[model samples]
Target chain A: MSFELMLFDNFLIEKQAVSEVLLCNKITEDYSLALSEEQALELVETRSDSLKNYGRIEFGSGIIEKVILTFADTPYISQYRYAEFLNELVEIFYYFKNETLDLISDDDLIGTMKKYFDGVCQGSLDQLKFRELERMAKNVRLGLDPDYNDLYDSEKLREAEDDDE
Target chain B: MNSVKKTTKIDVDKLSGEFYFQSLLQEAYVKGVLSPKESERVQLECLKLLADCTERFTRGKSSSVRVEIAQGIMASNLYTIGIHLKSLPDVEAALFQIENESIEKLYEYGLQVLKRKIKVASYFYNRVCKTKLKTPNQAYNITIDQGFKPFFDHYEINFHAHEIPSDIDYQLIHPVTDLAGVEFVIKYLENLYYENLFCSYFDADIIDEVMTGYDPSYQNLLDNICEQVFLNALGCQLLNAPLHPLDFSLADLDALDRQLKKYSQAELQRQLKTAAQELITNLLLTNPSLKKYLIASLPKITTTIYRGLTTHSLNKVFVPRNNPNIKPIRHYNMGIKMDDAAYREMVTEFLSCRFFEDKLAIIKEQIKTLADMEDLLIAAELKAAEAAMIFDLLEDIELAVLTKRHPLHPAIDAIDYSASEVQMQQNLNAYMRALPRDRLAKILGMTTTIEVV
Candidate 1:
């Protein structure tokens, strides 16, 4: 039962991950969003740092390529700060994966992020992270629909109450 | 013909049992048998297996897990692999399989072994239940009854193969150690089955009497009952007497003392072991495993006998039976009680009395039966000294009946008695402890054999 001595170093995984991330560029290129090799490696490094910070261990190819392809066509992202945007998005995705208690799948969580970024978040990563995604994670934890919002429900109730008054 | 003998560089005997996989890898690496590249490949494959397990754990909905969950899956995978490796004929074969096969394949093989081990564990558990001793010992009863239910119901072999899920509390003469999970349970049940089989030779009621003779409150003790029965049986064999009663009389003790005083400690152990072997044969025990189990307990039994001999307390080692069959020589019937109306009035007045002397005066005047006196003793909040004086009014037989009926258990049984009862018990116990040795022995001896109507 002892795993105390086994190192979880990602030195070998990072090279493979970097190539996978660069392969996503061929798809993102159609959307005018492309990452250089350096940018791809940085994104992989960002995934590693986020995993460590969040006390998580990812196996296999991870969700980096998935995140890149999923977020490629979003109007919020562009080539100017595409690498930086992906890095922050990767970190936020991992942080919320834990916040959601792993009940939400990788695909579902990434799709929800893309929906909020283009919709109410209006391309604001901070809004998506701090506000929309936080609410969604809370809903998932509470066994409610992932899109359930008490704020919106209360607002509607208050408007109806005022109409009756 | 040329043949190369592939010997393992690692000494299989020195590896840890609980951490078999880790220790085996460690010894292999230290001996330079497993190169750095091979070790890395194993670690990576182990991680890959963990990742695959995590996916199955989460139903492939998540790509990441908390580090603890991952580590648990990793350890379970390694334990599974270790089980398979251990099933090999020798350490060399184990090492060869580890070097040549994929960890996933080894883990699959381990799962197969684990599946078969579960059946083996089930067989042992059934044997243990069938041969379980009938006793009033709570730990022994409950452990046999309910301890392994959780293990059979919810043993998580996929992720927690190294964790024992049972709550076994009874102590065995030879405790199960250096094993985990199902292996630990199997060894424990196997030993218990043997102990039960040994104890089954004597009558259950006689065993209880012998335990009561050992300690009037031996039911609460965690000591193994079988060892005592075996020791007493061995004592009977040494005395050339019948082993059914499993009791030693005072004359038997004197006889044993004179007989064994001649042997030195080593000679005493050798004699006891030989007697144990003879005792086994007398009982017609042909099972080699049972014979071996009895012989294995000789060291502990020998130490006990040796200590008893040196201290001149062989009576304590080979205890006499408190034969419930013995008729009491004297019986004192508690007379009829006063009517409830007068008893109620007296208790109210006694509770109203401010001084201890007044309450004692009321008790001496109104109490007609031991039953009413016993009731008032509890209802009244008398101090220890007051209770002791009240206890002095009863005869030895009356006191013995009260003592037997309301035996003062130690703090271990504190939770069962009420505060008022505990106060009365402590007072009664202190009074009995202050009595002369013969008087106390006579009272206690009567308590065991006396019948109350």
Candidate 2:
């Protein structure tokens, strides 16, 4: 229970997470996206830092590999900025997990993040973070559906009027 | 070679009950009983157990949880293990189990102990409810009736076993201390059940009269009723009188004052202890635990008796019982209220009036009953000083009835109040504070006895 004893680096867990991250390269390489062993370790370290920064603790194999596999085929991500994008995605995932008060499951949250990144955000991490995920987290906290957006309904109504014209 | 025996390094008596596991580890490490390598192994196993518990906590759906939650699970895990360790024969046996067993295994043992402890707690709770003292004390009644319901219903044994989830506001004669979570609760309930069992010996009506003699307003006091009842019963035994009434006359108090004044502090404690023993014997109390519980309270009772004797207040200590059913000296009828339709029309006209003089004139001409006046006091938009004028129309008994009904609760002011009601309360408080001291005291006293019809 002591913090000093409980907060060790957990080297074995880190190594396992790194191996899981590297395993995603098999599926991700189809999209010309791949993570090297060093990049995989850094992603694991990023997951650790993000978990610490967001006051979260992960047990067993983590959601990093899940994030990588889910976001790999997206047009928004490429090998050029893939590592940095994955780091931000890992960080943002933990941040919104808390922001949503854990009401959203890991798979659902990751699936929704991918849906928005490809659909609405259109490759803009800032839009995904500041606009889409913020509203989604607020919706979850207010006990509404995570995708409930009144503005979207009004805009859809406006678009229908434009079609009628 | 010198043939000298080596003494033990750790003192078992010095270990804390609340943090037994942590202190055991610390003491074992400092005393050179547990090696650093062994300690590190225990710590590593504990962390692994925490990881397992966290996975269980999230039902394996999520990979991560908040840090505070992980910390709470870790503390709960350690406390569970400590409970098992405390069940072992002695410190060395506990240390041996800690050294040899895996933390997960120790945690399993703790879980078994906690389950048994829950049954024990429930048994004591039922006993307490059965023997609960029949008194008008709100804290005692509510604590006995409703306090442990949440704990029984929602106690999270895995993640929050170290937390006490009950509302226990009633104070025990010997407060349960140095324990946490279920152990603290079990100890408290056990002590309370013993107190209730002792009080069950006397007739419930006699106990009520004794509490009334202690304080007519004893219903609001948080003081333990059992302690005073036990002291009075002991006083009855001290005077060789019948113990059923549990009352002491003035002559009884004077005789007790003279008989007990001859002893010093230690001698007085001895006398109380002997009288308490005889009390249990005469009352036919065969429960060994009850005997110990009452005897353990002798020192405190002796101090109270000694202080009372020295201060010439033996009557306060061994009070004569009074009938709690006495009628009030003055009965003030509120009179009949006007009908709702007519009162509403009057209130509308009063609110529409622009001047304070007009409001006062309207009140004087139309307000006939105290009920209509009470409602108007809340509904009207009169200022503080203006509201005092309305209060001036009521007699002392009427004010006492109102004071009893609308006691100035600071907590209620934060929610569910109208502006006019707040103003009325402030005005009434200000006016009552400005009353003549004698008249205010009389009114306050009447509040306890008055029943407004």
Candidate 3:
């Protein structure tokens, strides 16, 4: 078989493995909610296209599975928004991979995303994206102290002062 | 009618002039035109004459002068009467007689022979220079064409030299008789030119001495010098020193040579020591980033990591490969098949990842200000060993991504860059204290050392 075809087959097998992980984790308990084979393939294509803007992707990295698992537990991401959420998360992950200078581990970054999503943003994807993640990226770029909580508190204080004035 | 039988067959075209003459004398002995003793005596005299010519050529004397000398010897009747015959046994004597009778004509013929040999050597030399020799920093002003033009011009003017000829007798006359030898000579000359061009440096008689060695097949000598030149270029680049042709000028080289000549040996040594110290200081301050990058780019470090990742046998411990929660981190025997080009490409990717990752870690955790980063860098400079360890750790972490059988590692996981941070700071403090008072003052922005009484 051709090399690309072989890689595609391997990718499908990996995606199936990821699907099993999602089911076991109770993120999608039923087959109806689980990612179908076609959905998994489409997700792979979308992730690949998203990663191109950042840098070259090594084949067989299973980046699609990693991104899927990362955002699978977001509380308010409806079944309808599942694919779109995975697409955005892949884009953000790679976009920050370049922005954060690849220093932050994928696990830590997902944890941070989870923290802001559950705590401050309260399951609002747009607020977690634009306000929290964008601010953290900006602070990193500016070479500020990386304590996200400190940055968020200071920003909150500054906004409050602006309101008071 | 009785016919006389020819006893010896000689192909005149197959032999050189000297050899053809020798063959004629042998044939004469067989034909009974001359006795064996007479032929032997004449052959011995001819050998002596050729030996004299060879010695003169080896001494760098022009072949025309040697020919004229031979003619002068013949005119003075240095050979016996029987040796003066013009055919068969007389061929040697005939050749000498022509030299004596028409010295100018013989000189002209010798010059043509020399020119023809030179023409062939030059053809091979030019081809090798154009194709095989690499002058990485060969720019317009200091190009090989310009550098070799003078050598060619010198040869053109000194066309009287018959040191190089097709005859086997003349092979010892010139250093380079064969094309391969010519190639080595051209490569040696090209390297010398590059060193002079880039380093603003030249040893006055090194090239001349190498040429005078008369060994055009000295490949080891060429390789050793070429490697030194390459290293020098790399050093200069890392120092941010001006590269060849860009910063080099003819006048600068001349001036340096003049100044070097003016210094006594002891004075030159003292000056060199001071200059070296100052150069180190200037390099540290001016090009720290490049120096650190070069240190990081050392082949010793990269090759070790690359070899380990690509070839080292894995110690496998099996776990379920797909389950993320099980943390199935195991050494697998799945080696990636790649060539040198592919390996290099992957290494670049890994390095980029590492560089950014290190920067992000510092920005996210350690750095609060630009001064903080500077302090860290200065600390690194003070404790080089610790800094190298940190660098190695970071490189390993970056390389680990490619080694893993599974890609389940989170892209945003936290990595610690403070492994040596505390110790680096301690070393930096100690180094600051140990600095000379004047040097410390300068670093502290003071014009002079403050007296502590």
TM-score to native of every candidate shown: 0.74, 0.75, 0.26
Q: Estimate, for each residue in A64-85, the C-alpha lDDT of model 3 and write its tens digit.
A: 5555565566566766767666
lDDT per residue for candidate 1 within B344-396, as digits (tens), equals: 99999999988878988898888888888888888786788888888888899
Decide which is better by lDDT, 1 or 3. Answer: 1
Per-residue C-alpha lDDT of model 3 across residues B392-453, encoded as one tens digit per residue: 43322222222121112233222433434444444444544565786555444321222111
Q: What is the TM-score of chain A alone in each candidate?
A: 0.92, 0.89, 0.67
Question: Tens digits of per-residue lDDT for model 2 on B192-215?
Answer: 999999888889889889889999
lDDT of every predicted structure (CA atoms): 0.86, 0.88, 0.41
Consecutive 10-residue window with the lowest summed lDDT within model 2 chain A:
A1-10
Q: Against the hidden true structure, what lDDT does model 3 obtain?
A: 0.41
Candidate 1 accuracy as TM-score: 0.74
Q: Identify the runs in model 1 with alpha carbons over 4 angstroms from their true place.
A: A1-9, B1-8, B35-37, B215-221, B254-265, B307-316, B322-453
Give DockQ for candidates 1 onward, in order. 0.44, 0.37, 0.00
Residue pairs with clashing backbones, model 2: none
Give me the displacement of residue B288 in model 3, in angstroms: 40
Better of 1 and 3 by TM-score: 1
What lDDT does candidate 3 reach at residue B91?
47
Q: What's the best-to-worst order under lDDT?
A: 2, 1, 3
Ranking by TM-score: 2, 1, 3
Instruction: Write down the RMSD of all candidates, one decimal each.
Output: 13.5, 17.5, 43.4
